[model samples]
Target: MNQPASAIEILDTTLRDGEQTHGVSFSPAEKTNIGKALLERVRVDRIEVASARVSRGEIEAVSGIIDWARGAGLADRVEVLGFVDHGKSVDWILKSGGRVINLLAKGSEKHCRHQLGKTLGEHLNDLRANIELAREKGLAVNLYLEDWSNGYRDSRGFVYRLMDGLADTGVGHFMLPDTLGVMTPEQVTAAMTDMIRRFPHLKFDFHPHNDYGLATANVIAAVQAGAAAVHCTINCLGERAGNASLAEVAVNLRDQLGLNPRIDETHLVQVGELVEHFSGKRTAHNAPIVGEDVFTQTAGIHADGDHKASLYHTRLSPERFARSRRYALGKLAGKASLLKNLERLDISLSEENQHKVLQRVIELGDSKKAITSDDLPFIIAEVLEGKDYTHVELLSCTVTSSLDLQSTASIRVRLQDEVLTAAGSGNGGFDAFTGALAKILKKKGLALPRLVDFEVRIPKGGRSDALTECIITWACETGEVRTRGVHYNQVFAAINATLRVLNLQIQGSLQQSRSIDPTA
Candidate 1:
């Protein structure tokens, strides 16, 4: 019988199998950073850092990871994948300072007979020789039965023979991979259960691929059927459809199966982002746990439920992952959604004005998707035209740009009663505008807030003339604020967004002064 609630080990293969992702490669420094984060911060049980003898770069990456892991008293937890080239792979691993080697062996008869052109006996001899050499050198060994899923399905005898030959070899973990990601959850459960029942003493780990989008689900099945550990990759970076997502697998194991995985929940998204940045792969906005929009409430009703009584809450709270819940404001926004966003911004409005703002937001959503909360002030200012949010405004501006040449911006702006002219140059038009704007603000003994994130996009399927929307995030004393601007030209859009930030800053200062002064 399978245990109901036991600890499951997580073996992250992002640096090894994950590098097989198309056009994705991590440098030695990147690998070291990721490895440190995984073992020190995210706290996965084990990490497979690289493949042996791949390159001089691979050696450097593995050696760096091993050096750190050893100093941290986690040398045995770091693993490197190696081939069945007798002593060569073992020697390479030792050269890289790795203590554990995940040896790749043909699991399926077809792979053995066709790929390696070796019979079962010959392959067993090679695997035993490699295992012996690893044991003699004081290196831990884990065997990967590559394509174990099909091997068990097509020819159980071959799998039985392979396991029989290596059953007493003192291997740490026998990792079974669904190499083509062709197993359904039912199949995984049956195979994993049978393997456990048959072997009884050997530790088995299930490695799943996401070609069928069943990697996480298959992990659940494998765990329920007694897999001691499961393999995953950060951000699901792997060949074909990728491997099981480390975040998804860890969360599901805890929530669904009552299993404890050695994962630090708060750092899941942090590590995912690190991997995303280094791998140059953009995770989908809706990807679970680590996606940008995963914690955002898009539906108005959902926000309402959350606002009234936390009806829409779950154990998967964003706070658990060091993130905050966001209510998206768009055409689907309602009174509750507006209230939620208003609450976040510490802004209070009359019911009538709130209604007005909601209507405008919906109207904008008809053309745009979701208006960021940073954009709310602009919408509110426009909806209540009586409000004085525009304490500063740009009177006129001209920007010029040419390829391979610095861009220049000449701007004339009215700061209260004074008109100022400033010119500046930069690598791009927006940069030039900021340079010029900085000079103007410097005159007033104020500096613009540091820019944090800038994103520009257009309506999906829109033409070249389609309006460009630029949302700029800035670091302020309170925290962060985002301002949005829309224009046909992308540069102008960014400039408009920047102008909005300045107006808001000036307006806030005036309001603060008024509150402090007895007479003005």
Candidate 2:
């Protein structure tokens, strides 16, 4: 293998090729904003904003991008895809104020024979004419050997003939594309080495697709094989499985190949978000570098290892991308996981309270699936205030509600020594549950206190299955008392809060009776 270059130029084609993604079309304004962010913030070396003669909107978009790029002294860095229709594509690009055109030509004999029905010599003549026209119009040219991977493999002579025909056309870069994403790393290494060795004076850029999920790997192979630059798209947006992800390509080029790319690490996720929003396509949560959960530790053992010795840490730290590490709270949570989150929130808990809180987290996780650090305070508050009382136990309860119909509830509860069943109807599920509890209390010559206030909340950015926290305040004869509960179901959260109140009220009444008469 040939030695890698010191640096590589990244040409982000998200706006042009990425728009080919299914159901994705960016408005001119959206394209302008993304182009600005990619060049100004993310600092990519080049951007391909549109294809020549696609639409009036594309012309407007390219004009906007080119205008801004020129003012920023980066006009030549912005490119537009152009076809080989003599001077038509060159004129379209000129009308859009574009200074660079990536001229597309067939690389394979099959494509030239079947798609265009022209010989390689005829195709070369058309390409030379287009290149001459572009140069005359003061536009730099880059030729895309479309499907060069298959071309090199099947008909090396056709590829050599095409190259020999245009070797002196003054095309700045010959971009080689794995258009169908069929080449393995070994194949890429061999072909890129051959292309570089044969055409030692020419610069090459590798454009890869992800149909086989090897775009990033193939990029490594190409870069190591002495390619000068590479082509990629943001969030891997493109036709079919999409192009190589810009984030993965940039990072791997730097870390795996020891080459520098003009990319601001912090702004990677920022641009990824911009494309993800404009394209209306959601990236995978586990996508490298820019994924939502890439930096999160869900395993208790991993958190523990990191806390003790940074054992589970890697160079791919979240801080590198302007994100923080989070220790997930769930059934897998251990004391170390709880401690890590507590330390993040700057909270100090005694060992006993910490144990209690950890247990509550595990119990809640059984239904909530995952709990974020934002939910930690709720669990702490609930566990700290709850008493170890066996005065009342909720055995089984069922609450049902329907549209335009009164809700109904049936409950079996054990109060001190008696197990009683009661049924009631009310306005909603929680209201019906309270009505049933009230019936059982009425039989014991007791009444529930007046409800002063009730509040419910979930963690920030919480999913639908996140834990629900319910806090209820009741007014008794003495004063107001508050109780809190955490559960996956809002109704059950309220019921748990109510049970705490009942336990407190029963304890208070018993204490008063003992004070009034020693042996009644």
Candidate 3:
């Protein structure tokens, strides 16, 4: 492999090749959003957004992207895929306001001979014609060798001759694609090195598919072998196993190979999510760099190591990508792991209390799945506040949820020495209970926290009597707050969690008053 270069260019094809994933289609607005995100936010070098003449909607999407790109001074960074069909593709591209055209040409001898039924010389004439037409139309041009890997392997001379012939054509980039994703890293290195050695003046970009699942590795090899750029799709969206993931390839170029890729690492996850949302592709939680669970520490040893000595830490810290590391609370959590979470929550516990909490966490982990930080206050309240801290208590809650009927709740609460009862109804039992609680809290001049998100889950292999954990995220005046409640009944679990939050707020209010007037 050649010595590393300063930086490699990234061409994102999430809107073009990525949209080809089976059952994935983006609306015109979605296309514009992704295109803008790739160029403006993620800061990829270039983006191939659509194929020429695909559809009216596609044209509309391209027009929208071009309009934004022009206003943002990024019009030149956008590209469209075209074919060597005389001037039709170029005309289509010009109509869509595309500035760069990636012209698709036959790369493999088999494709050229069998698919196109044309001689190599005849194909070159058409390619040259198309390039000249695009240039005449004021469009920059790149060439996509649809199966360049196979072409180099089977007919090296044919591949060289094509480059030798077109070296003077003033094409902006020669995009070499492992269209079938069949090349190993070794093959990619050797072929790309040979291509660079022979055509030293030509700009080359490597595009790898994931059929062999070595697309990222092959991309690294190609870059090391002196390819100027690499093409990728977000969330690895493409046909078959997909293309190399833009997130994986980009980070590898930076972190592993020590080359500058002009992507904003912080925006990778955001762009991946946008593509996933619009494309309807579910990203694997364990996917490198952009997966949901990639930043979560599951093992107690790993968490403890990080806390003690930063042992498990690497340069690939989550903070670098605008994400926070998570020490998952589960069966695998140690005291150190629990400490990390408590420190984050700004809650301190005695050593003995920490041990008790750790044991409860482990027990719950064995039975259930995720337990968030919000659950800790309830556990602490149960263990420590047996009598004190009962600012407001739910004396009784009776909810009726039945088929084809609105859920109703009758709740009685004790605030200090007084008892208040209220009845309310909603489409769900939890909503009904919250409504009743709101009515009673209104009488006490206390308002409920704004519910932001509610998530519920049961234990693994949950039996009929398994405990239900209800986690609620609240938007408080200070910030966001999360609380958890586990109970046999789901609605009761939510109520228990809500009560903990209410008590916390009430206690906080009392502390504030006390601080203002110590004499009182």
* Cα-based lDDT for every prediction: 0.92, 0.89, 0.88
Per-residue lDDT of candidate 1, residues 393-466 (tens digit): 78999999999999999999888788999999999999999999899989998788999989898888999999
Model 1 residue runs over 4 Å out of place are: 4-6, 386-388, 458-467
State the lDDT at 366 in candidate 2: 82
lDDT measured at residue 37 in model 3 versus the true structure, 0 to 100: 91
TM-score-superior candidate, 2 or 3 = 3
Top-scoring candidate (lDDT) = 1
TM-score of each: 0.95, 0.75, 0.84
Error of 3 at 479 (Å): 2.9
Better of 1 and 3 by lDDT: 1
What tens-digit string does per-residue lDDT give for candidate 3 at 367-458?
A: 86567666666556666764436878899889999999999999999976889999999989999999999998998789889999797878
Q: What is residue 459's positional error in candidate 2, in angstroms? A: 19
Candidate 3 pairs with clashing backbones: none
